[model samples]
Structure formats: structure tokens, C-alpha cells
Target chain A: MIARNNVVEFRTDLPGYPWQIAAGDGETWIILRHKARLPVTQIAQLKNITMKDFNWRIFTKALSKTLFQGTVSLTVQYSEAQHHGEELPRETWVDEHLARESFIKDETVTGKNIVRKDSRVKTAFSSILLDKNMLNTGNESPSEGEGIWHLELPWQAWLYGTGKHQNPQVEKVHIAQVGLNTLLLEILIQLTANNELDLLNTQLLEYGLLPREELIFKIEGQEIEQILGVTVQRVFHQPVYDLESKKLQLRNFKEVDIIFISAEKGGERILTASRLMEEMQVIPFWPRDWKRPVDFGLFNKWLGLVKVAADQILFQGDYLWFVRSIEEMGTEKITALEEKRKNTLVAALPPPRKKPGEKWLKKDKKEQPQSSISKKAITVRF
Target chain B: MVWQFSSAGYMRGQEARRPEVLPQANPEALPEVTVEGLPPQVLSSYELKIKSAERKSPNSWLLNTSQGEYLLRELPDQSNQAKTIELYLQFSEQGIANLFPLEKTKSGKAYEKTEGKLYYLTHYRKGNFFKGDDISHLRLAAKNLAILHRQTGGWRKEQGKKQNLWLTVKQNRLRDLLAYLHYLKQNKVLTDFERLFIENFDFFYDQGQESLEHMVLAGQEEAFIINNLLPENITLLDDKLVFLDITKWNTGPQAMDFSLLLNSYLPLHRWDLDLIKDLITQYHQENPLDQKARHLLLAQLRFPRRYWLYSHQYFSGQLSSDELTPKLKRYILECYWRDICLDQLENWLIGEWDKNDSKE
Candidate 1:
């Protein structure tokens, strides 16, 4: 089982000792040791792993003791091997026959008749073989593609009677390894590579699990059209951003990662990165290495864990600046927004005298229907 | 109007002693009441007088008298004032001096009549207005209010009408909000804020409707409730707290009193549930709440009155949107607290009820 520190260790009654998985400096390592000696190391670079590099197999056998006694045995093997070579040397084989036992619980049903053969084979091979021709000729130059033996052989093995006699009586054995984190890490790396990290973060923030920073955007120029396009599709229509007026500054943000770009039509506006996460509908797998109270150090660690491409860090300063701006701008535009709101309201209201055949406008009101425009001296109540 | 002049023959000075022979009433000089229209008896009665008059729904005088300070005021509804004063008099008889406007006129009438105008004098309760955010004061006030409510519980003769008073108030509030929404829509130009309000009108309107329905479902019995329980009306009398105004007393659900006081005291958009829960629990300890009462209380709180009030005022031009914008945002933020308060109250109520159920 994996510990809180992400270290994993498991033991099996196999030839080797326990297997351990650990992370150091964001790199994961898998270690296998044999009875306190002979340690084999495998580096699992989660960012580089694919589905084909991992495999495991299971084997089972049964032994008969007496007329009604039997024992089942199970073994599991896991290996990560890369293709290096194909053929090997084969020598001699010895076969021995053994007696079989018939045990039947039912009177009419007997155990199947079985023939068993145990084969012992021995073979020897050398990775480095001396060439006698080169020794005799005393050749000073080395020739390529020259080896002691270049042999290719096709070999096959089968159990007699559909492998019934080959380890046939064993039950089930469960074998599992920590491979999920590797796959998840791979997906995250891929997403970062595709520049979709912001999108994923956006989805997470939208789920509303994490705290969000307040951001302000001044959507104007052609951005008005862009905003209207987004607003029109919503089920509930609000007239908040549907204007094609001046450089209208609107303040209110769902998240902190925001960007504003100028375009020819109305200017394009986008909320990027940290703030982008706010609009996310689904929570993404956290990219951070450490748990909560996430600060700058934790964020940097997360970036390292995700192995964010070096090019992305160039914009890190920009992201930090944007976040800082959001923090500084808190509650500043509230007053201005409110002012603009009042102006918009006044602009939206009709002059008391302008409405055709309006009865609510009193005789005195009709004389100066719109009090706001009447050059009336302002009164300071406070 | 019994205008007490300088007692019948006291001013007849033909055989009176000279100024030097006459004994001085005060060795230390008293401030002169020099206004031409002054009542002669008022000047003679109070030695040290500092008086001012201000109109606040009634012609009232703030003056220092020989007896003590007093708020002399006229009443719009003499009969209602009499009824409330009678209820308070009974409460005072039970040692609930914190309630009941203190010290009536010598005639025992809560109000004295002058030119057919009914007036009354109350000894100025020495204390500051309930202005601070100290929730302890709120807790104390709530406790006293619950006591006051329970003590005067049986004063209402019209039980059926009072029982439905909360429902009527909610219905009226919802009606008012609707009217304001209509007024907002009637404007020719609308701001983004106004538009947003209109868009979310149904959601807010539904909250009002739901609160009313919950009140009806709870069906709590009514008690004598202070209908206008503004925080400013509460005064700290030395160690004791008292509500100075009994202008709008009515037979209503006790929950109305709780809602009024809370709505008045809680800071804008900061509905600290701990404060609310503590206050409620403190009050409940004084006067236990039944399941129905708890439900009614929650229902009363669930209505977003501040948001509605600010928005209504802004749209009606009674207040400039710009002037109330910060306040509006505050109210909006406070809106979230309503749900939190409701959820917590519901949990506590359920927990308490379950414990009671197990005991039974």
C-alpha cells in the first residue's frame, strides 16, 4: 500500500525480496532486492511511460498426496523488459514418468486418467565468444557483423491434452502493482504539452472546490460583441455586457487567471491560467505535489511534478503579475461599477413627460419631467 | 389639555416679600427659560432645564426636569398606545421593569391630552442606543425580548388574527417587492445591475413565497410582539437593556420580533451564524422554542429583506443606485448567509426535537 509520503512496498514469496516504489525530486524509482542482496533497479519516469511497457503473468500447479488429499499452488510474475535479442542455445533434455492417483467423491464419477511427464533441460550460452579465425590470422583490423555464432531457431512448447497435465489444479492468485499514478501522470504531462493545462484548471475551478481570486475585466470595443455572443446562448439572459458602447470597463471575475487582448472588431478578452480554472465544471486531478495550504512553493513543486515544458515558464512572471493585479484591485472597482450602474439606470429611464398620454406624470412633474437633467442644484444631505 | 399655570395665586405678589427678603429656591443660579411662549409652570417646576424639541413622527421634547430627564411626546394613536402601555404596566407588575415604558403621567394615563392631542412623558432611560456590533448585547436583548414576549404572551385577545399575522406580513412584503420589481421594469433605461435583478427576480420572489408557505405550515401561536423592533429603539439602561419605543406594538408571531431585531443588528452581508445561533439558543433557554416556533423563526429569517429593501429603494429613486451600490453589494454578499443561517437553524432545531422525542 502507498503511504502518505507516496512510498510503496510489497512482498511476495517469490525468488526476490520485497519491491519498493519511491519518489525523489519528482522522479519515481522501483527497486527489487533478493534476500537482502542482489538488488535490481528500475527507473519509472511517469512522464515517459506508455501502456505497452508493463506486463504480468500467473502460473498454477497442483500436487496429490493421498486418495483424498491434494494441495494447490499459485505463482505470479511481473516483468518490464525491452527487446534486445531473440535466439538462445539449446542442449539436452531428460524426461521421467510418475504414477497418477485417482480420487473420486462420487461413486459413478472417477477422476480423469492423466499422463504426466517432468522434463529437465539444460542449456548454456555465451554473450562474448572468442573467434579462432581472428586469433590464427593475427588480424590488426576489426571487421563489423562478425560474431562467433549467428543462429536463429524457432521453438514451441505445448501441454499434453490441452495442458491438463501442466500445473492444472491451482486456484486463483491476485497480483497488483502501482501503475495508475503513472498513467494519470502521463495524461497530465500530455495535457501540459498540448497547452491545455489552463483548460483543465478552468474545469477544476468551475467545480468550486478551491478558493478563487477576484478579477476585473474591462470588456469593451469589439469585446462587446464577443461577450454578447457568449451571453446570448445562456438560458437566462442578462443585459449586463450586451452594449457596443465606449471603452466600457466591467469589473467582476469568477476567477483570477484572466487576460485581455485587443482585436480589430471589439477587442478579444480571455481569462487565462489560474483564473481560467474558475469556470471549470469538473474537478481535475490536483497537479500539486503537497496537500493544502498551497502557496508559491507548493505551486512550483506542482509545476515540476507536471513537468511543465520550459517554454511555459516564460509566461510564469506574467501569470504572477496578473494574479497580483487581481489582489490589488479588490473592491477598488466596486465604487466605479456602482457609479456606472447608476448612470446606466438613469440612462435607461424614460423622461416623465416623454411617454405618450402618460397619466402618472403630475402637472408639476410634466413641467420638468427629468429631474436629473434640470440643472437643479445638487443637495448634499450628509 | 390641562395647562398647569403657576398655581392659582402664587404669582399674586402685592403683599409678597421683596427679592432680597424672599428665600432663594436655588443658591446656585439656574438657567433661565427666556423664550416668550414658555409655559410658566414648566419654568417653575424644573430648576435645571436644558430642553430641545424635534419632530420624529411625533412632536417630542427632550428636557431635564427636577424629577429626572424625560421624553415628552404626542402619540398618533392614543388608544393603541393605551393598550400597549396597559400590557407593559402588567409586565412591570411581574418585575419585568426592563420592558414597559417607564413612569406614566400622574393621572395614570399613558398619554396626557392637550388641544385634543394626546401626549405622554417617559423618564429618559439613561443609556446609549444599541449601536455597537457586540453580539453579547444582541444575545442579552434577545433573551430579554423572549422574556418580554413570554410574559405578555396571553395579552392578545384576538388569537386567530394574531396567529396569521406573520403570514400577512410576509404576503405584504412579497407584494411590496413585486410592486418594486414592476417599477424597476417600468424604467425606460436599465443598468446592468437592474437587469440582473430583473433576471433573478423569480428566484428571489420564490424565496419570499417559500418563506410565507413555511410560516403557514408551521402555524405557530401568536404573542404580543413589537412590530417595529429597530435596533435604535433599544437602549442600555445602566446594566439593564430596554426597548424605548412601543410605537408599533401588535399581536404577531414571536418570530417577527426575532427577525426584526436580527435584521436590524446583524452587519450588512455578514450573517455570522455563530452569533445568530448563540442569540437564538440564549433566547430559547429563557423561553423554549417548539418545533413550529423554530420553523417559523427560520422562515422569517429566510426572507431576504435587506436585499429587497436596498434594491427597492434604489429602483424607486428614493436612493441613488450609486449611493447605495456598496450597500447593495454588501446585501448581495449577505444573501449567501441566509441559506447558511437557515441550514444551521434547521439542523439545531431537528437535533433538539430529536432529543425531546427520545425523552418522550
Candidate 2:
């Protein structure tokens, strides 16, 4: 902590992203949007984990991401600031710790960066979603419109943030609308009956962990712009306000890791993932195994991120963003933050090695025991 | 007929159009019968019933829809809480009833879960003077519980298979008391009343945790269910009594279930514990009261509010309404907190209670 004629101590934790805090000393800093990283050693672990166990990689990466990015506030000793002589006309005082802007962000914004480019499943499903009120399609009326309130982006949507989980082909687009049927309503009503379900359900009200809403889905196996047989609804574009409907209030916000994997159709695709690259996009992934530079279905590989636009899940925090307005300076700062973010990512990517009996270009000589593979076609009762 | 529509936009109750209800009949009864009157369900067998009426669980549905009424239970799956079904006879005037052995699909499964928890459907036995109240009948039940302990002694032991936290907790306390016993060659923690209990434990544990289990298997409340009887689970048709839904755990010590009942259900000048000694004395074979068990029971009796208040706190609102009447709830809470401090006096000497009462 360095004391000056005016400016207080600057932050030393983020040395890579330095701050020149001598304001009007002509020293200015583009305050980094966020601090995130995945070291080189972690990458090796992730690689080993990916080869050794798939779920281990997933759970590990999820946990690691949270551990690295989890925000915890701290406060050291601070004494009352010696007030400046100049009648700090608001602005100057605003910067004062006494009047310091707590830096509250909008908690949400127009979503972007959702798409995958893997060559796995045949084609991908992609849709666009925008904040509902962005269009200002205002309609204040009686009758059927009573429940129709302002459609603001949710303060915290269920599947908001996380590294990535989707197809590998859809072009980068600002998601416009996503149709979802959080099974929360069914769970709640089913629980209110005071039967055995209600009794068992009582054990699940912990924070950031609620009984997940059974995902209402329809998959035709073939790529269609909309899920086949499933009519798509508009994005759940709404404010964080509860609509007073027990159904709406009880909505479960959760984060799900949906991994889409495929090799050269017939190649062995198992690997370790004990550790992982903290931050990376859909591109520039280097997989082992030679010949033909194989991949999964690239066209529909990426459908984008699942942004529900509300705290509709207990698993969230990855998809949130905030900028006072679409100001270029703020957005530019964010971009710079994104750039610095990439360094920590590539450095930490796990370099997986083929096991002793395994070969890069060769598929395994033996298949897994029949008992290990799942046979039950996880059926959902409509 | 569906009763209501929940916010999830689905019909509630019998006609909710779930996949299909599983049958609750013996598969051998109807090899190929399609129960025409029932909703579309996957049933193994079909049979005649006198009637059917919707009832709260343990007995989910009382069937008078035919000649002889049966009980149908809609079970929940992966459910943790245990409720009695399959065996408790409810002979209420609600309908016609008859007693029959448990009937299950030929697969020999007593219950099955389709969309929810498992349910059991059985013939309701005809009976009289069945007090179904939650906590009474334990007094009369003391003897019946003893009989059950004697009868199902072997099979039930095989059923429970594992010891819960009981033996370990008892032994942990005993090692300290046992060492004290060795040091003083006397029961240090027990009064003469409790000394008997400690001796019981010393003698019991001398044989080990298995001995405790044996005591349980052999109808020992000092090692199992207390002898305090409740009239609720008992059926006294002019002294021809019956006890069912009987478990190895609930049929122990004469003090096990009875003392608590007197306190909880009967409005008395402080749950007349006088009934406890009497109940224990009445047991057909007087198992000597281990001084240690006496001490433990009295100590436990001293903390009765804890067991009742806490038990009620977690599960029961039936004693009160949705449990929201805060003043009453507050009174219970205040008594609980007050007792936490005042209980020391009550635990050591009842006179302290009168002293505190006089000061107040």
C-alpha cells in the first residue's frame, strides 16, 4: 500500500493486468473486466483426467472453474480518509471510498458467444434470443395480459454461466430466444400434496441446489432448425420479478454440463480430464489420433449457450454480464479483459498422452465390457 | 374424476393420465383379467372388492367399491420417510372390512412403485375398539408388543439386518461408566435407581453389542422398546387385544413408548409418570429393572419435553393447525427454551420446579 500526495495504494494482486492509479497524473487504466486463469500444470491434469475418466474431467473442470473464478470479498484495515480541501463537487467525492460507487452491475445483458464446432452429431439446432423489452413491445391491458409483465433479462438465469456446453457449428450470434419448460411447477404441485413425495422433497431446499426441473425436450436425431416434434416457444425473456404464480416463483435455476463428443466416427474417443484449460472458445482444440484430421458433424455442432433470461435454475453464474450502457469504452475494456483472459487459458490446457497400450492413430483392440455401458434409454414421461 | 389442476397444467388425482398405475393385486388371482372399471394400468391380477374410498396414507384408499373392502396405497418411489402400510388394521365405521393375508403379484413383491412411492394394498380386518389416535393405546399395547416381540423375534431380526446408532451410542457411554465402575468398582454415574440400569448394561455389554441385539430379539426393553403402552396402536375389543404394524424397535422397554404418550396425549398434571412403574410391573414376565436403565429412563423422562417438542418440531403439525398459530407455537418455543435452563432443576429434583414456580 503506497501513500501519495493524493492517490491511495493500488492493487498488486493483478500484476499481469497492471493499474496506473495516478489520476490526472495522466495515468489511466482499463480496469480489467474479470480475473480468470488456468495454469499449465492444470492443463496436464485435465488431459490425464480426460483420458482416465470423462465424468472426472467434467466434475473437475466445473469445480476448478468455480474455484478459480469464485468471487470472495475481503477487507483489510482502513481508517477514515483525510477529506480533500477542494469542495469535491460530487464527482471527486464520488470516487472517495466514503462515497465509493459499490460498482453494482446490471447483472445481465444481451447474450453472445454461443455455438460449437465439433464434428459429432448430424447438424446442430440454433436459435436467436434478445432481451424481450429490447423491442419495447409494450402491452398493458386486461384479460389475458394480466400476467404479461415487462420482459427484462433475468438477473440470474438457470443455465447462465460455465465454460461451454453445446454443438460445434452454429455461427457466433447473439442468442435471441430459447424455449424452456422448467419442471419446477410440476415438482412444486406434486410436493404440496403432503404425501410421500412431499416428505422426501423436503430434504432438497439447499442453496444453489434445488430439485432440477425435468427438461422438456424433443430430439429427432436429425438436425432441424427447431427441435423436431417440439414446437419452440419464445425466449423466457422476463425480469427477475416473480410473477406471483407459484409456478413462476418456484422455477429452478440450474447449470447443466452438456458434452457433445465424437471422433472419426469409428475412432476411440476416451481420455482424461482431471484438470482443464480455464478459459477457451470452441476453436483451436487439438485432439490426438492421426490420419484424415477427423472430426464430428461440423455444420450443426454448435447451437450456442443456453441463456434462460432469469434465475430459473440453481446452477448459474457463468452467463451474467453487465455494462452501464453500450458505451464503446466499457465494451473495449471488456474486450481487453477477454484478450488477457486467453493467455491463462492456453497456458493451462492439458496435453494428453496416449496410454502404453494405446496409440494415437489406432482404435483400441478391445471394447469395454458389456455391463459397463448404459442400456436404459433414459425415458421421460411426458 | 380429477380433483384439481395444479399450476403445471395437469389434472390432479386418479385421472391425471400418468403413464399407467401398477396393479395392487395378486397376479395368481386373475391371470388374464383386464380390470375394466379401473383406469388403464399395468396390473398383474384383478379381484373383487366391496368398496373403495380415498383416505390419508398408511391406508391410502379404503375400498368399499365392491362387496368386501380393501385398502389401496399409492406409493412414492425413492422416498426416505417410512410410514406404516400393508398391516395396520383400521376398523373404523368408514366401511365394510375383512382380514386377509397380504396379497401381492406372483412376483412376490409386497409393493411396487410406478410413478411415485411404493404402495401396499391389503384386506382390512374387521375389529372393534381400535383407537387409531397417534400416541395412546401404548399402555394396553405394552403386553401386545411383548407378544409380538416373542412371535416375530427371529424373522424381524433378520429383517432389520443392521444395528442403527443404538449400540455404539450406548457402549460409548458405558466404556466411560465401565471404567468408572472398574475404578470405583461401583457405578459412579448411576444413582441406586440408575445403578440397576448400569448393571444391566454391564451385564448386557459383557456379552457385547450382540447381546444387546439378543436382548432385543428376546423382548428386552432395557435393550429395546420401552414398556410404556399407548392405546392408539392397540385394539381392545373388550380385552381381546391385538397389536400390528409391530416392529422390533417399538416393542422394547415398558418405558419406551408409554411415558411419552401420557405426557403428549393425555392432559394430566404433568404426564403422570406414575403409570410408567405400573406398566413395567404389569409386563407378563417381569424383567428386572436394571438400575442403569432406571437411571436412564428417569433422566430421559426428565428430558421428555425435548423428545416431544423436537419430534413435534420436525414432523407433527397434526396436533395443531398448519402449525402457524404463533402464540401457541411461541408458548411451546418459550417453554422449550425455558426448559433448556430450568430443566437442570427438573432433572435433579422436582422441588426446584416448585421453587422456580414460586419465584415466578
Off by over 4 Å in 1: A1-382, B1-58, B77-95, B104-108, B157-162, B168-189, B315-317
- Where model 2 places Cα greater than 4 Å from the true spot, the runs are A1-382, B1-46, B50-59, B65-67, B79-101, B106-108, B126-138, B155-255, B258-263, B266-269, B284-296, B304-360
Tell me the whole-model lDDT of each prediction, alpha carbons only.
0.39, 0.26
DockQ of each: 0.00, 0.00
Please give, for residues A187-266, the per-residue lDDT of candidate 2 as tens digits.
00000001011111123211122212223121112121211010111122221222233121111222122211111111
In order, the B-chain TM-scores come to 0.74, 0.45
Candidate 2 chain B has its poorest 10 consecutive residues by lDDT at B90-99
**Which 10 residues in a row give candidate 1 chain A its minimum summed lDDT?**
A92-101
Q: Estimate each model's TM-score.
A: 0.41, 0.27
